[model samples]
Target: MGNLSVGKADSIPTRPKRPLKPILSDAKNVPRRRIGKSHKGRIALLHAIAHIELNAIDLAWDLIARFSNPSLPNDFYSDWLEVAVDEARHFTLVSKRLSELNTAYGDFAAHDGLWEAAIDTKDNLVSRLAIIPLVMEARGLDVTPGMISKFRAVKDYRSADILDIIYSEEIKHVKVGYSWFMFACASMGLEPKNTWQECLKKFYKGNLKPPFNIKARNLADLPQSWYI
Candidate 1:
């Protein structure tokens, strides 16, 4: 007497991943000068922002479609849904900025590097959290402030504005990762700090660089002990 919805087995949804070569080709062909020099080097800046946004879109979708474990609570799906929405919004912000620069997304050569990590972390929930949000996306917190200051120096308000939204939302995204990661850690009786240390030593792409946004890490609900 097994439960199968009283009839049919559960089904997983299918969503093909985004194409890469096509996106990169469009990016390469677009002329860089169409963006006004009046914008003070903002054209290049806007293009870079657009590229990150595009990659974020793919990251969000991949998480939802691949991690469809019915045993996880509905809150799990809801959490990811929020992330997908924010990623899409961030994409729009940068895309609009590019338009104001007289350019568009896909106007420069970019790679699918963001999705590569998603695929690598796909097989396990802990690996997914430890890699995607904590290691990769959280790097944005450490790096974006400097980028924002540069844009501000160039008087590119739009670019900085878009970055502000991303920085704020990224805190929440990282928090989501931390929540689930702790849940998984507890479920498996793995000490959180030791597990993260082992994961970093094993799967981390590079050194866990410093200049971290300590405040944001706390807000993201990372173990307080790590911050101290």
Candidate 2:
């Protein structure tokens, strides 16, 4: 993970070098494994989530460094710095779990889909916020419950508990994204909903799959009208 100090936000490079440990592959090429009760299956699932958290750590710092503006408040930097700390913690937890399972993060290949959003929205702060936290991380709130239940059903309480923490904290992460996105919209004199829709259309390649966790989204202050 990158440095979590907000004081160094401006000094950090816009696009840092990618980690070389886990080999990256296309999403289509990455094999899909069901998170069944098998130990190996659990490892794969946790590894994938670790990869996401790792990328999230990078994304948060990149946002602070790449888009730091004199007009934006200090709260913006502190908010993303908090997110970076959370992501680093999440990755460390998952990596520890993987270690307990006799494996580690780089033991398996991971897809680079998460970072693609960053690459696509590199030039626009509003678009970056719209896509990464609002769209990408919000999707986590939608799907995490089912994942937690799966782990619980399989009697993997440790993993389930970890996911539960992630699920709860992720609501705040999405809210941070929403708040900042709205702030940026107001600053730029753009309509929030329309700008978000446009960014999704231009930058996001996938559809907004249903079965959304409306309750969680609501907790994050993300209106259903924006997505549905």
Best by TM-score: 2
My TM-score estimates for the predictions, one after another, are: 0.81, 0.93
Local distance difference test values of all predictions, in order: 0.70, 0.88
lDDT digits (tens) for residues 1-228 of candidate 1: 123222222443333455443254443454353233375346766676666676676666666666666666666667877888898899888888778777777656664555566666667778877877877877777788877777677677778778888999999998988888898888888888877767767776678678787777878877656533
lDDT of 2 by residue, 1-228 (tens): 244333434355545576676788876655464677789778888989999999999999899888877677888988999999999999999999989889998888898888877888888899999999999999999999999999999999999999999899999999999999999999999999999999999999979999999999999999899999
> Best candidate, lDDT-wise?
2
Question: What clash count goes with each model?
Answer: 3, 0
Evaluate residue 141 in candidate 1 and report its C-alpha lDDT on the 0 to 100 scale.
Answer: 78
